[model samples]
Target: MSSTANISTRTPDQLGASRAKAADNSTGKTPGPHRSKHRRLWWTTLAVGVVAVIVNVPWFNALIVSFKSDGDISRGALALGHPTTDHYANSLGAAGYDFPRFFLNSGMIALGAVALVLLIAVPSTYAAIRLGFGGRFIMNASSALRLLPAIFFAVPYFLLMSNLGLLDTVPGLILANTFLNLPLAIILLGAGFRDVPIELEEAAQVDGASTYRILYSVLLPILAPTLVAVSVLVFIFSWNDYLFALVLSSSNATPITLGAANFVTSTGIRWGDISAATVLSTLPPVLFAVFAQRFLVSGLSAGAVKG
Candidate 1:
């Protein structure tokens, strides 16, 4: 009996040890998945950070160089021993290109284009998405239009503008920008409008709302974020467009882009002044991007899934 009892006690001890070992094994194994997940997250973060730095480095370098003198910039030197505001001062001063005039012209044209694009695109997109009138053909045509290079239409556009006596004016640039940006605006806003629940519109209509009233009160509010995104995109496109401005605009209606291009003379290129102006010129887009980044991301993601 004593021998059996001793065996039983030893067995229990052995079983307890086995259970403890198992518990330890399970506990230790749990960290493996966590470790792997952490590793993956770290790698993804590192990759994104690296990419961001790579993309932003050129702009950062240009900004730093903008404050430096012409000689300092030419040497490709990192540290500016004699940094000065001369470049900015010169850029803004009478001696440099008329930055103020150019800025104003570009702003007005971009704002006008964005406004018109939104006005036309929102209604068209609504009709396309809600009414479904030749939706596939419309989308396909817009995509195909993008495939054709902008320069292809430049000659035709120039001739048309000249014939209409609309050449070298803000109105001409505004119209050109609108046409160029309209397709993209329609694509984006159409996708946004489509994502709106049909039930909501139906409910609005059931409440004795007219089509225009339903759109204005119900749809526009939901599409506000997307509208902001499209506006920023259109503004950037219009602001940076050199080719259209070059071809369409003359001395009286010259935009900042054309003015910047003209900075390079036959004799020499003014690197400091050019870089300063470029940096300054980039501010509006940058500011808009920074402010609208969240909306932009949301709009793009939502549009992509629906579109």
Candidate 2:
């Protein structure tokens, strides 16, 4: 069917009706279908807004109570009060919570894991996408491996780390994190690399630029945002890991996710302090999500189209 209401090929009576419809549209009377669509759009937008607020209620409550005193938290999770910095201090180890140490350990593992994942993934993904040597199989295998249960791999990694005397150490945690998250990094970073026009690579080759030089000087600049997005995702994964950290670490390499449990000991739950710790722990991932959101969006959108 045509979009125009004025169909010249219609019968005389049909043309009269079409002319009346076109006049109605021009005069803004339009039709019921368009009005119904507008109503549906407004209703959907309102429903989405309500759902978003509902989903974020808990986070808002946590933020509110994190600033309250131990006594004041009992008032309510959403209750407002003049806040104090005491919980922040205690959460950061002012009262011997060891958050600083936990932060250091988490940072070491997260940053190291991101570095290792990218180091292995970048060139490999680039080659897989561009070089075309069993690229399809490589992608399929990585995806399959990613879907396997963590325990399947963790058992072997545990034994290996134990034999290497790396258990309860930063490097051990980093290794575990990198191993678990590497496939995802490859799939994501490769998407950005895949989007890079092959003509650029060929042009560089024609100019006598080596593969490594082209990758470093030409591709790296284009991939900076993608790199940041990948790094942030990997960092969040490593930072928020509870299972691998719990299974692999003892006292030597406790991260914030595990260390946060200290507040729930037999001494009774320190709700205020826990809330504070939770709030602080939320910052890194949130900051990274905010900063790299554009690149992440672009990467995902491109991945959808290209893949």
lDDT of each: 0.79, 0.79
What does the lDDT come to for candidate 1?
Answer: 0.79
Put down candidate 2 lDDT per residue, 1-307, tens digits, no spaces.
1111123334565664575557556765545645655675588789999998899787777777778887788776656678877888888878887778888999999999999999998888888888885668877777777778998867888799999999999999999999988877777777678778989999999999998899899998988877876787778889999888888888889998888875566377777788788888888987765665665555445444443
- Least lDDT summed over 10 consecutive residues: which range in candidate 2? 1-10
Given candidate 1, what's the lDDT at residue 256? 88
Clashing pairs in 2: none
Model 2: residue 170 alpha-carbon error in angstroms = 1.0
Which ranges in model 2 have alpha carbons more than 4 Å from their true place?
1-46, 75-81, 265-267, 299-307
Write the residue-wise lDDT of candidate 1 on 85-152 in tens digits: 88887787656468778888899999999999988888877887788867778776765665679999
Off by over 4 Å in 1: 1-47, 74-76, 94-96, 132-135, 298-307
Every model's TM-score: 0.80, 0.81
